[model samples]
Target chain A: MDTEQQVMDHFEATCRSHGLKLTHQRLEIYRALLQSAEHPSAESLHKQLETRLPTLSLDTVYRTLATFEQLGLVKRVETMSSQARFEAKIEQHHHFFCDQCRQLIDFTWHSFDSMGLPEALMGVGTIRGKNVVVHGVCNDCLEKKKKPE
Target chain B: MDTEQQVMDHFEATCRSHGLKLTHQRLEIYRALLQSAEHPSAESLHKQLETRLPTLSLDTVYRTLATFEQLGLVKRVETMSSQARFEAKIEQHHHFFCDQCRQLIDFTWHSFDSMGLPEALMGVGTIRGKNVVVHGVCNDCLEKKKKPE
Candidate 1:
């Protein structure tokens, strides 16, 4: 859903199906997650919403995100960082993280996605999902490193 | 590095090389991380070490782990879970995480490792490392699911 209205509609429907209340805070949180490309953490989300939502507490953001995660409304972006990052986009994709700038970029791997699970993990479990995180320096950071002061 | 003494020797050498003090708490924390296979978070580590070191606080565990991570002595295991997990094993390997049981198992992907980075990721950045996380229900959890109470 590209538009805020579309996202709101989806959010309302999802909440209804899951029997969740369509609170203003929940809508705002969901909208923020949908708009953000940074894969923000709960703390970051709270900070982002604080100006608009002067009364919103960090605890509320944490609880709402946890509830959304439990219902699969949002997916957590796994990273080497201590704080957990999150995304509203739950599509099948991979991530490229720039260690220098600490940017989390999403990229799809059609070949890997089509190949299915690796032979190594065959008998280990009932497979659900797979994610690949590539760590490196992004082009912008690399270029910045190449330039002398 | 299998034995505790071997790990201690390596830890001492690493600490000396990195110009870090060989404090008793740091040594114990490193040893505990080396011994654990759970990819325990700082809170969990603090809980595990508290009885042994009554004065040890969760903040200490967090700070020590961040220091170790900075020094490349310990690596963080990325996961969908909110809490960040850590491991002392720095070798190149991937992980298999059981969503139901929350168990993190290590496995090597020689084929994927040998193949190198995918062409899709080419020209995007200066590649450093890659990790694959497969999420699923472990055999034990699957077996449990099969049996009715």
Candidate 2:
């Protein structure tokens, strides 16, 4: 099986193992993350989710997203911006923040597993264990600059 | 000169170079950061600074601390907690976060700079490069486990 399928299987098994009910809310949130390319804030996700699940509480989205983040199905990217952004890529990778648009793009095909931070670093709370951030303008932003005659 | 003195001198120089007026508020905030071992949240720093500069505004403390963080005179450590934490150790190093105490400690000896990330990882918007975090329990927590009554 391919990686995405494997990841889906893992999430399903994880939910079962944790005895977490795979409710409509959970499935909708997971599907939303799976479908989304933009690193969206919880508020953004809530707004998108409202169209399908009109009765969904913003608090429920936040709580469920937090749970998914803790479950390793999503990533929370830290920006200087007030709203927190999240991505669904589970594999090891880094991100680039568009300075102009403030969008985040996944810089894939990288792993920090061999980065060799000291053993003591592992002693803190559950470390996601690695961090990598790249910030700059995306190609779309660059293309926009070329648009003016 | 000792490290703290050297750091203080550097802080002052950095301020002068940046054309920032080195106010008592800034200096006191820097002093608190320099003297602190525990990575302090802005609230904690404000409380400490309030003792010395009785009329200092919490907003001023927050703003000044943010300015220092931006100038690289101090660093911010990401936490699961709501508030961001600051550390005085400006060198390229990892951190040890205590899950129970919500404490952040400096672990200065990691040499991950030589661990080359792949070229594909260097995409646009890669600003200021990368930082690595290896989270886990610290030695103190491990020791705390073995305590006998």
Candidate 3:
């Protein structure tokens, strides 16, 4: 994965090289995604972009995200939520999902990137990539539980 | 995870002890999950159970799977796919997802279950549970691509 600047540069170059049209909505969506520290679902992105793109439909946000995925501009994350989420395709990183808040926090660990596939898997299948998802309540959620309303 | 017989024994015993209602719908769904060698989406599971459960609705299939998950009888896998898929809670194992065919194959690498959370993750918060998902092209998919249709 790359940083925000790198991702932006790649996004622009890819769009330009491919001759893909960068409509206002698509550009804003990409910018919003790059700025978000957490992977944002389409609905959440739409919420974030409401003031800028007042007329944007949820459907258009969904379609644009899919197009971004096909163009290799973003990655779709399957984080067990009802809504689909998108993350800027940076380098290899893992996610800690705060189930209570439905938030995904990213962290990098070099060991995981170099973990040779165990002998059993390598023998049967070709290994392309892997991700370790540590799923549980985050401190924020746990602390919230402790506090009384 | 446990063996098939053990899982069956636990399932039956748990249902009996908790007085969990096992309607025909629930039992058939459990059997479908247990017998399946692959994680299946609701649509796929419904298709499998259609003949055996002529009156079964897709909604019913979805609801029953959720109930089973809550009861700790099944695990919902959040792989990077559009549809929600599930696994029968048998033992500790990881999934190998084939990008080409959108298929999930299970493999066991015991070390992962005991993998120490790297130090980076330790300082931030509590560690609960983690799953390792290896994504790549499966042998079958590669073989299919090689041959003519």
Candidate 4:
């Protein structure tokens, strides 16, 4: 994973190569995505940036994130929810999503990393990346359920 | 995996158990999802069902799918794309998504199926399901890229 500054620099270089202007909104949106560990959606990002960027609209945030996605500078985290979540960490990792708490936690699986693609997927595609999302009730939620009201 | 008829019967049972009316629209939407392997979005489903149900609206499709999701009658296939995709097959399986062609293929990994949850996730949550999505350029797209147009 790149350092925060390195990620920002790469973002700028990628924008230059794509002939896209490094607008304030775009930079802020990318920064917000980079800084957040929660894999926030556009609406959440817009809300976070509202005080700092009072004039920033949610539509602009959505469009900027879409452009970043097109440039391969960011990734959209897969979720069962209707809203799309964005992340700037383009690293090899998996997610553990708590269905009860709605928390998305990232964890790396070395065994999976070492294991090659499954035999079943041999001819399916030119494999780029694999992501696993494990959905369950988090420990805290389970504890809460255990305790009687 | 349940047979198509079995899946539909289960849907009816679930709706009835939840006290949701087994309305024509809901039944048709669930039927379309059951029949489709594409994991279509609400918009695509609405377009597919429009010919059969002239009065059905996209909003209804979206709402019905949401209700079905809340009721655990359908599973939303996670995708990087903004549009949410729905699938009625709740069995243990995985997906291979082609970024270029936008094709979502389902494949079962017995090894993954047999292997218990990774050691890292032991305390993170009470695991219910693990879904793997592999993203890549499909074979056809790679062939197209190789051939000079």
Clashes per candidate, residues 3 or more apart or on different chains: 0, 11, 6, 0
Worst 10 residues of 3 chain B by lDDT: B119-128
Query: Considering only N, C-alpha and C atoms within 3 Å, which residue pairs clash in candidate 4?
Result: none
lDDT of 2 at A70: 81
Question: Where is model 1 more than 4 Å wrong at Cα?
Answer: A1-8, A50-54, A146-149, B1-12, B19-29, B42-64, B146-149
Which one wins on TM-score?
3
- Tens-digit lDDT string for candidate 1 (B1-149): 26768777888898899999988889889989998988999998999998889999889899999999988889877776667889999888888989888898898787777665667788888889888888888998888889956
lDDT value, candidate 4, whole model: 0.87
- TM-scores for all candidates: the values are 0.80, 0.80, 0.91, 0.81
Q: Taking the candidates in order, what DockQ does each have?
A: 0.62, 0.41, 0.70, 0.70
Candidate 2 lDDT over B1-149, as tens digits, reads 35777888889999999999989889998899888888888888889877689999889978998898889888767565657778877777655556556566766554565565556755463355555444556666656777934
Query: How far does residue B87 in candidate 1 sit from its true spot (Å)?
Result: 1.7
Interface C-alpha RMSD after superposing true interface residues, each candidate, one decimal: 1.6, 3.7, 1.6, 1.3
Residue runs of model 4 more than 4 Å from their true location after superposition: A1-3, A9-27, A143-149, B1-27, B55-60, B143-149
Docking class of 2: acceptable
lDDT of 3 by residue, A37-102 (tens): 778889999999999999999999999898888887788886887678899755688888876787
Docking class of 3: medium
Predicted candidate 1 versus true structure: per-residue lDDT over A1-149, tens digit per residue: 35778767877898999989889899899999999998999999999998999999999998999889887889877887768888999789899999988889998887777765667787998888878899899998988888956
Q: lDDT: which candidate is best?
A: 4
lDDT of 2 by residue, A1-149 (tens): 25767767777888898889888888888878887998887888889999899998889889988899888778777664667777777767666667689887676533555545566554444554555555567777777888955
What lDDT does the true structure give each of the candidates? 0.86, 0.74, 0.83, 0.87
